[model samples]
Target: MSDSFPLQKLQNITTPFYYYDMELLERTLKTVSEEAQKHGFVVHYAIKSNANPRVLEMIRSFGLGVDCVSGFEVQRALDAGFKASGIVFAGVGKADWEIELGLDNDIACFNVESVPELEIINDLAAQRGKTANVAIRINPNVNAKTHHYITTGLKENKFGINQWDLEKVTDALNKMKNIKLEGIHFHIGSQITDLSSFQDLCVRVNEIHEWFVSQHLAPRVINVGGGLGIDYEDPDQNPIPDFEGYFKVFKEGLNLRGDQEVHFELGRSITGQAGSLITKVLYIKEGVKTKFAIVDGGMTELIRPALYQAYHKIENLSSAAPEEKYDVVGPICESSDSFGKAVSLPRTSRGDLVAVRSAGAYGEVMASQYNLRNIPASAYSDQL
Candidate 1:
């Protein structure tokens, strides 16, 4: 059912729901695994993207590890059947309990962001009488030419350790007894479409690796965190991202050490195009200059549009009469509750089925109950 909506089945279910194409998801997983394995690079699925139960289970079945940002996500990954050794926890602000939780589970590595956080993890691990494996999350200060808010590698962003403090960090690691520095992690940003950004990251990483090697610090793993972007404008044309090309960028650019392992933390590229938000048009209001196709699903169900002013190609699946322009909006009382301004679709009417495509990532996971509205349910193609 490539790009074809199951309208009859959708009509029987509730409106404003997420529809996942299991076939597409599996295809994406298989492609990523195969391509990443070509270079023997390890891939850790970033759970912050979707976190749907079935989705997580499917991803786990593919044998990909997980990258988590929060303590709950680490638990969720564990509950989803991911091994503790396969899970890598990384976040800027990790509480004491969170660090303790990771230590309790004996997680693979904690991508520590700051010197203070490093000390905390070391203390927690000491309390547990265990050595906490850690990877210093370094901010390479690379520019991922995506949205400014999503860009995280710059010096201004509060995500990773600053560049000039490598000496201090290594000094602390040498003094700490409960923390074992095993890796160096770098995550430039998210939703990055340009492969050149990754290439640039590879160059910076090589330089950074040299600094560590000069200090006789041989980091076993070099984790270049995921930020691969998907084609939001045309999901059908490219259902799966070009994993081969994406991997080749690193294979050709990165100067891999003989004893080092490369790892990635991909989220959006794997899950973005495999699902969509299916909402029924509630009203068609005529305006002075243009018309509006109001849908039951709003920013609460999928906040990317409202939060990032993002683009999701809207389709009037039930309409075949003619094409028309519309300002697709939601029922929310807020002014920024719009999905798209001046969107063109088939001549729509009330009760028409409208789909917001390329919503598999950062869509449902970030959903909120802002107006006391019930959270939207999900339906899968395999189940249907």
Candidate 2:
């Protein structure tokens, strides 16, 4: 659905702020909940995507769990009203205190990425006279075919345990009495548009699951970590991701045992289209080939475009003139600090309000204070 911004009201507020369509976010969460519930699957909102308190609160209200990659994230989830029992800690380098935090809180599970981490969790759990529930995060070597920066499931990635090392992990698990092997986890990558990548992951997961079963260590939960991408190109046409089809892939692909649970750690697909970076054109500089629509906001506010060369549709909310090609550059010192180059937009001018669409997931969360610029403020549609 195309978002209808209140340009009059938005103009009254400061420019270069994040404008969240809460209605859209709620609808996305509702769809995810309904679709995941259809197959009795558990969903954990990957908090790293957007840890905004309001967003987290809304997600928690939908009865989804939280997937945390750090101790701070775990605490943030707890502070946001998500129950400790619904938090799952995941990371490659969890410190001792982070592990201790999970033990003290009795979080749902720790998606262990390495045998050393597993051992440390066990040791810490033993010290507290507790058993830490853990899910072995396996590197399935499945190519997500997305940006290499976000592809995490391949053997070269530092995210999960490689298949060849599973034997060592199993042996370690056998001796770690304080650790409970509750499940197996896999995260292929981020911004994955191809459903076939997930299918490949499912096939790999089946093989790994059978191997685990052969070793008499069948996991109770199969956590297929979330990599479902959203339509960054055209948020209007596909605002809500196809959760129905996404869940169906897992339902038909996975070979689940009786009473086994399937879990997902979705982040972007649910929130990507719900927010936009609202900025104001500061100056129009004539370039050799294309005009430069330099906006007040830059990579400090949204870095996806600069970091991964990601595409986000730019619209001139204040312009209704005929379309023209303009390089929408941000007011940053770096040459790469741009939203889009050669972007087609309505005839833009100074003071025109512009919107960078499909940025809800990684926009506000990854904001930085580079160039001493204040992190952009946020405004919700309902509040506006």
Best by lDDT: 2
TM-score, predicted candidate 2 vs. hidden true structure: 0.99
TM-score of each: 0.99, 0.99
What local lDDT does model 2 show for residue 19?
93
- By summed lDDT, which 10 consecutive residues of candidate 1 come out lowest? 1-10
Scanning candidate 2 in windows of ten residues, the lowest lDDT window is: 1-10
Number of clashing pairs per prediction, in order: 0, 0
- Put down candidate 1 lDDT per residue, 272-379, tens digits, no spaces: 998899999999999999899999999999999888999999898888877889999999999999999998898899998888999999989998999999989999
lDDT of 2 at 222: 98
What is model 1's C-alpha RMSD? 1.0
- Where in model 1 is the C-alpha error above 4 Å? none
Give the TM-score comparing model 1 with the true structure, all chains together.
0.99
